[model samples]
Target: MTMTSPVALTERQCTLIARALAEPRRYQILKEIAGQGGSVACACMQQKHEVTPATLSHHMKELENAGLIEIVREGKFATLVLKRETLDAYLRELASL
Candidate 1:
């Protein structure tokens, strides 16, 4: 059996994603992650945005909790992987509503 990253969803997660997408900056972060082939690190994103580490951390946590981005930690840094399929599914479900 091949192991793959988990992609579970709940009603709350869906709602969280919908709310997260409502913010333009958050949406930009999501798009940036997707554009980077589905993953980017906090440090890299901070460099891209030229924001303070504390501010970046807060935004990252919001994105992480929304399930729009997955965090893969390595030492003191984490790589954020865009959950593209999950995001697209959420959008499709919203459109159907």
Candidate 2:
């Protein structure tokens, strides 16, 4: 599959990305997802931060909306994975700016 460039993200998506990076814990969450060898479970993401489940859910939503993370549901379980290429492209865009 062809990967999408971060420059393709819309204004709303860019806002979501900025919001996600603004929170330290959310930033850590992204790191953890990247470090994980396999697809991370959404439930597992909660264990990485000290925040409440509600807050974790909110962060997940922001990351998803930002297109930085992709969620796939298998039966009752949801997996979260970092879109590293997209993230790299985003950082590259910022670097060029």
Candidate 3:
């Protein structure tokens, strides 16, 4: 696999992504979201991961800031969706290394 063009990722974006994935739990959370099809309810993730609401919220925010996930909120419910292109670009960069 080849890495995407350097222009596709700024140094700051790469750093943010790396930081977001540095934590094991955060990485797992990302994987879970990716595996859950198009999108998943935060409540469902809470049940699956057995984490407190606040903890899950923190993880989600980290992923969102890294551009790895997108969240859509409707009133009290929030749905989490994986940003496949960002993850794919990151993986391609890793493969290039």
**TM-scores for all candidates?**
0.82, 0.79, 0.85
- Best candidate per TM-score, number? 3
Q: Please say which candidate is ahead in lDDT: 1 or 2.
A: 1
lDDT of 1: 0.82
How good is model 3 by TM-score? 0.85
Candidate 1, 1-97: lDDT as tens digits: 9986645567898888878878777888888998889988778888888778887777778888887888899999889998787887787677767
Encode model 2's per-residue lDDT on 1-97: one tens digit a residue.
9985445555566677888889887788888888886368988876667788898888888888788888898898889988876687678766767
**Candidate 1: worst-modelled 10 consecutive residues by lDDT:** 4-13
Local error of candidate 1 at residue 78 (angstroms): 1.3
Pitting candidate 1 against candidate 3, the one with the higher lDDT is 3
Q: Which stretches of candidate 2 lie over 4 Å from their true place?
A: 1-7, 10-12
Residue 20, candidate 3: C-alpha displacement in angstroms = 0.9
lDDT of each: 0.82, 0.79, 0.86
What's the distance in Å from true for residue 32, model 1?
0.6
